[model samples]
Target: MNYRHVYHAGNFADVVKHVALVAILLHLKKKDAGFAVLDSHAGRGVYDLTGEEAARTGEARAGVARLMDLRDEMPPALATYLQLVKEGGPARYPGSPLLAARLLRTQDRLTAIEKHPEEFAALKDALAPYANAAVENGDGYARAVKLLPPPSRRGLVVFDPPFESPDEFETLAQAIRDAVRKFANGIFLIWYPIKSQAAADAFTGEVLAGGVQKALTVDTQISAPEGNLDRAGLLVINPPYGFDVEMYAAAEILAPLLRADIAVKWRAGTP
Candidate 1:
């Protein structure tokens, strides 16, 4: 419950996660029908990169900071993400909820849930400008199941949990199963830290064993897994068509820039 994203906003994982996020949202927009987005574990919607929390870690320096100078070199999907970050201003970084809100169309809707009270208040205010967006103070995982099969019948659910609990993997595995059962067609994206290869593999196995038909696992490692925070990944369930091709291209460019090893693979079905 003590986990806060302020210190880690705009870090490398955020870059990978948000790049894919923008790509998915763009895909959803291709159709004339409106869609909904549920940001489970939504943090404070926006963050000040210069604030004490960010300053303490300075993680963005190695992440978003490095990309700021190479805007012309980024691929289409990444360029879009970079543009969003640039719009947030040099010292400001938009979290997932804010990013979704900015990209949402008038016909679209967004529901962001943050369990932490302080973060929830910040999220509510940050999303207030969007009439189509709503903020709720509650457990995001639980909220995910309840909000599935949105009235739009087309939506995306992002699970960016703070894996502070030892059983987080198991918890997330079940959550994925439940979410898929409630809304099989909905896109589900999960962000996880790779502290140990064995644990990560086991977690992936558990999720696959839950009977999901299509899943993709993409990960980037800035360095060898010598510590707990060197690597991160995203497990995407029921991704949009051509998403893997586009994401692989983005990952190729991102890994070199960040000095990381990038691995993109389909866990359940062909791209």
Candidate 2:
């Protein structure tokens, strides 16, 4: 698997995913008890939108760049996301780990896992400033599962794999199964490309088949795909209360800028 997230770092899908992540983490923080976050397939943590890879695709221009002026009137989730983006500066973007790390409170902890050696090294440096965040080099899926029922007992497991292999969906489904079996109460966020709606739904069904109740899906369709992946979806198992509301609010702001048609649906239990 030679796939890298740098080229597509700050696209429309990423905007939605990261916004949802912020909402979830914020929800987790409301409680006094500590919560953990596992970022599987963690990238280099930070991305340079002006770099060669990002410029080649220019995905950021249509994604986070359009939200540079996001105002305080926006929902807290979007506002927090915008603040983090701004903190990274105009030419840089924060990946999941960096975003998650920055959001971590003293009581909360973050474990970021990356499969690529170089990405893992960069991940370490990116998270070095955060005493609450740890970086690991290994199979993100397996390592994340092994860290199940984290010491905190409550947490979020983020699976944002590259989906480079043919059995990517199957692997993701199994990982979710393992997560549910070991840590059913934990919140799980899984991202996947939607080249085929039917296939994507089937994969979602498989994950729900693992007995994941209270799950919701957030999807964005910027355009009908012509083989360049114009659509992607995120599955949130056990999403926090009002999570849908926050994501929808952020989507409304994002839709016009991206010309995207975003949908939020329940795959299992209701809000």
Candidate 3:
């Protein structure tokens, strides 16, 4: 379940995660008051499919490359995500912070955190064009929580850490609980690998047990869990209204295209 970003850029998991991100941002835009976005564990902003890392996996070819066609009709969320990716130019894939920065309105702001020196440097340069975006080089799990309860009181916390450590699930679960305590009303988009159903369930259950009133999980399994990783999950806490429907639309169109089984389920409060 080692999901390093460069190797799997624009993969099925990223496609689904980013589509949900766009949908949530669109919903946030409905309000005149600007909201903030904190992208914890933000990668190097952009990935190159032509690079050796991506060529080795060729994951983008089977994931996002399959859906790159410009069509007349598509879900708003998917369409927007596709448009942004296309605008990034050929073989270049935008990471969470880049996508969030692109969607930020004039009044909005974004703070992207990366612990790795190389990634943090690249992320800083990548976000240089966006005046609304800021970059931080630090431990995402700890730094992200301290920035909670954003000044606007309206924001999204994107928590998708690289699970390099064996205890990453435990760390993420506790981080979510802490984040919720500080920013209970803020929207949270958390990502995790689904290597074991029981482990994934326990992780999500831990977050919910932290008094998170409303939450939903979007799961995608491209194939049975075998040698290569096939399943992943995105857990959204306090999702906006109609958020699930938008994701469902994206899933219907993506399942066949990506050859993945996608499901959106309410794990806590009613939709």
Task: Give one digit per residue, the lDDT tens place, for model 3 in 1-271.
Answer: 3546898888899899999999999999999999999999999999887789887887788789999774757878899999999998646689999999999999999999998888888899999999999999999989999999899999899999988899999999999999999999999999999999999999998899999899999999996334656999999999999999999888989999999999999999998
TM-score of each: 0.96, 0.97, 0.97
Tens-digit lDDT string for candidate 1 (40-142): 9999999998788787787777778888877456666788888889998856698999989999999999999999999999999999999999999999899
Clashes of 3: 0
Ranking, TM-score, top scorer first = 2, 3, 1
Query: How many steric clashes does model 2 contain?
Result: 0
Q: What's the lDDT of the predicted structure labeled candidate 1?
A: 0.88
Candidate 2, residues 90-198, lDDT tens digits: the string is 5668999999999898999999999888888888999999999999999998999999989999989999999899899999999889988999899999999998988
Error of 1 at 61 (Å): 0.4
Q: Residue 226 in candidate 1 has what lDDT?
A: 40
Candidate 3 C-alpha error for residue 19, in Å: 0.4
